[model samples]
Target chain A: MYLAKIFVTHKKSILDPQGEAIKNALHRLDYEAVENVSQGKYFETTLNCDSEDKAKQITDSICDSLLANPNMETYRFEIEKVGD
Target chain B: MKFAVISFPGSNCDYDMYYAIKDILKEPVEMVSCDTESLDGFDAVLIPGGFSYGDYLRSGAIAKFAKVMPALIKFANLGKPVLGVCNGFQILTEVGLLPGSLQNNRDMQFISEYEPLIVQNNKTIFTNEYEKAESIMIPIAHGEGNYYCNETELESLKQNHQIIFTYENNPNGSVSNIAGITNKNGNVMGMMPHPERAVEKILGSEDGVRLFTSILKSFKGGILVE
Candidate 1:
């Protein structure tokens, strides 16, 4: 078995307004030392596959097709063996 | 012209679009479901505002996979008129029918009010009734109405005059003050403003009524004989 974790976020050039707002709020709360903040979505799933290669393929395909909008977002995922 | 208003799972403005077409314009219109596989017999397609799919993943990230999307793509390929408003606009971008994506407002607020919009291109079927550079008030209500496109796409959009509308005061901080845009072919349009919600003076402004008239007039060969 494999456990896959995916993270999706706006592209570097894209303006993340929600993240900017959060940064502002942090400053208001006296967290002025923080220079930047990026926000994104995270997903975890247990793949019923035994091979790491198969798990990676499934996770990548899902991220490309649905988990992120390529026009403004990018995603990265990691897979690890869980149980036999 | 007969129009089809697609009603996704969380669509709340479907009826508003229907009324704008059927009652106000006196044109034939029907409410289509997201599960519908065919858009046959419809001259135009309307995707109305609202949080489709409860905006679960993103505003429109999950809606491009709806059963009706394939048919919608075929309809657009035929050069038929397709208008997406608000969340509908978001869906079109997700489907790659239109360029750019709608993001959270710069101020991170859900803005809901009458906003001034300038008709940038009056030659297209969607804005033919308005004069070039004419400004009109329309209602815009959304949390993610800020539009963003890459520099290259923005340059091409400007060069081709594909930009249909721009805001007067730049309410949502959209790039280039863009409020609405069309595909290079000019058949498909997506706008963040709710023109359907401003069709009558009773509602607030009737400026948006001309937009519907424009589509109908184009179907009648750009002029009404009667």
Candidate 2:
């Protein structure tokens, strides 16, 4: 078994509306000095596979195909062999 | 034509849609709960606008795993027509049925007003009633309705004419002023406005009546007369 964790985010320079909203909220609450915020989703999943390399391949494909938008967002994946 | 409007627990616009379809358009409609397993009989499935699950854990994140979404996916995959409005639009993007993420409004505040929507693509089942480049007024009420898709996807969408409606004045800061989009097959549509609310003159606008009528016309195997 392997555990894969992924982080999906908008590419740098793309505006993040959620992050901007949070920044606005902070300023409204008087936290005026808070600067530069970005929001992203973190996904962790366990996959049953033969080897670490095979798990990596499957996980990468999922990220590219559906898990994350390769064009607007970039994703990073970490895989580890684990005993269930 | 038979249509079903899926109502989530926190959904507030189910009856609005029901009245829009049944009362205004004089079409037979069903108010279906979000957990319904069978959508095989309906000609169209509508995910009405509302703040589902009280907008928890991101706008449509929690509603994605509802009982009826799997059935909705099946309905969409079979090339049936599906329309998601407002919160329903957010839900579609979250489920990967649509391409972009609907984030907070550009001003970081909830906006509720009548905004002009320019029809960009009239080839889809949803927009067939309108002439290309026509503009109509509809109400948008959302705190998080900004649409974001990468540049590559944006170009492809334009190339394919998948972008159906664009904001007339950049209301929510959506990329390229996009207000709505259709799936690659053009069967599914998701938009960030409440067309149902604008279906009657009593609501201050009747421009939305054409949308429902257009869809019904298509289902009857006829083109929109207007």
Query: Which is the leading candidate under DockQ?
Result: 1
lDDT of 2: 0.85
Per-model DockQ: 0.85, 0.31
- Candidate 2, superposed: residue stretches over 4 Å from native: A1-11, A21-35, A39-84, B222-226
Q: Give the alpha carbon lDDT tens digit for every residue of B1-226 in model 1.
A: 8999999999999999999998899999999999999999999999999999999898988899999999999999988999999999999999999999999999999999999999999989899889999999999999999999999999999998989999999998899999999998999999999999999889989998999999999888943211
True contacts kept of each: 0.84, 0.42
Q: How high is the lDDT of residue A49 in model 1?
A: 86
- Tell me the deviation in Å of residue B16 in model 1: 0.6
The TM-scores that each candidate's chain B achieves against the reference are: 0.97, 0.96
The candidate scoring highest on lDDT is 1
Most TM-score-accurate candidate: 1
Q: What are the root-mean-square deviations of the candidates from the true structure over C-alphas?
A: 2.2, 4.2
lDDT of each candidate versus the true structure:
0.93, 0.85
Clashing pairs in 2: none
lDDT of 2 by residue, B1-226 (tens): 8889999989998889888989898878999988888887898889988889997756787788789988999999988889999999998988889887887788877999999999998777787789999999999998888898877889988988889999999988899999999888888889999899998788999889888878887878754211
